[model samples]
Target: MEMTDLRLVVATGALAAVAAAGAVAVWRRRPRPGVPLRAGAVLLAELLLVTAVALVVNRAEGFYPTWAALAQDGTTAHRPPATPGRLDATIRRLAADPDLPIAVPWRPPSLAASPGGGATVAVPAGYLRHPSWRYPAVLVLSSPADGWTDARMLTAARQDAPTAVVVAVRAAPDLDPGVLATGMPLDLQRDLRVTGHRWGLVASDHVRRSARDVAGRDPGRFPAPVIAAGPGPSGLATGLRAVAGQLPAPLAAPAPVLAPSAAAHQVGRHRPPAHGPVSGIGLRHGP
Candidate 1:
């Protein structure tokens, strides 16, 4: 088993043992009511406790197995460097496979100073074959709680609009390794997505840089008129990008869809032009 799985197993076993012991102690102390009823109550309580503990541990350790598998593999060591030949070949192979979406790690030289390393890019169909065709790109800012994943973005894009090149960037840097063992609640982590360490400005810059790099590498494959988008906290970043007019040439026009109040507030404050350069049509609700 993987180390994460093993650690989870051990932690679960220990918690179960402790719960069992506690239940037994409670039963012995007050042998009132039916035994089955008492046992059921104990089991329910233990189950809830276990779930709470597991969530805490998962957050603290950054041990989300699903996310770790996808994001970690995109690092420089694992993924081949992006080159025209390699990119074309990979895209061709992926295009042949009906099941695989064209999303992959984007590690252009411009992203060397990025706070969260690199972003994930999802290419549209026929991207490999049409070297002369240029398509609009969208930068997706992700919530720190769930982070960003190519599969998640691709799935969402397929359901909504599958034409543009969608880029999902991580909004937060790595959490402190020492915080993993703390007994803090998961709500704290959620709060940290916004309050503790703000990533709005940095994330916006990352989006700009990503769009520029993609256009620079394959000007004909990915072109101007890039859009900025996100959901929830990430949506806030999108709004910032739109308000600042950070997108490349042929800017997207539609305003990013934010919460009703936030959307109103931003529109009121920024008064973005009716025909602005950032497209924000697909983000009607939270992700």
Candidate 2:
């Protein structure tokens, strides 16, 4: 949720409390005959007042992106910044390529089964070109909104001890909200399912297929036996959490890292070689 929205909620709650107290005070002093009705009337009025307050609050905070227009003026002009990463750059290039292969040689390599019986797709740095498996892979779900750009993504892979791979499912175009509401948590799995149905596949059935496609298309890009996985804001833990239901084993929870560890060293170990360079991933777009 946006900080502004949170403040509004808090303010509305406070107003509701104050209004309720006032209603009770008014009830205590009312004459006896229609006391019950008087109390009910006051309570109803309070409720209406609270609702009005909440609507005004919503209008001010602009929490609902689709319906609320009051705050749209402030947000419409902003564009998210982009970062470069090898994978992000590759994905962006792939998205932009008019002549991209209708059928890229995609295959599903067997992934390490999560304890929950679902498979995890990992995209390590330079899975396309890097030789050393010395970069940490990030497990992303949907694409990063801002900081997790292609360049930034690649930079993360290059800079980290173990390169990162984004973990995400493709979604239907209709599912793209353009701008998500401030407080609504994204459910990529459901969105992907809806998106898959649009593509003429069963939603649940296609997740595995998508994962397989990711694995088959890029082998050895994701290092098997993951050292540590970090979830980015949208993609990380949430994506893993969604996939857990389908994983073969329980996925290990990520640990907080103040700094890179031995595994981080392992992921970045190959940068000294000619094929390896300690830099962020390349990108194809200016955005």
Estimate candidate 2's alpha-carbon lDDT, on a 0 to 1 scale: 0.30
lDDT of 1 by residue, 20-129 (tens): 77677667775466878678859866895776577545433434422223355434222211122234555555565643457666553323344655556666554554
* lDDT, each prediction: 0.40, 0.30
Query: What digit string (tens of lDDT, one per residue) describes model 2 on residues 55-143?
Result: 55543433342333334587552211121122333333454342221111111111112122221223442343432222222233232
Top candidate on TM-score is 1
Each prediction's TM-score versus the true structure: 0.32, 0.28
* Stretch of 10 with least lDDT, candidate 2: 193-202
| Highest lDDT scorer | 1
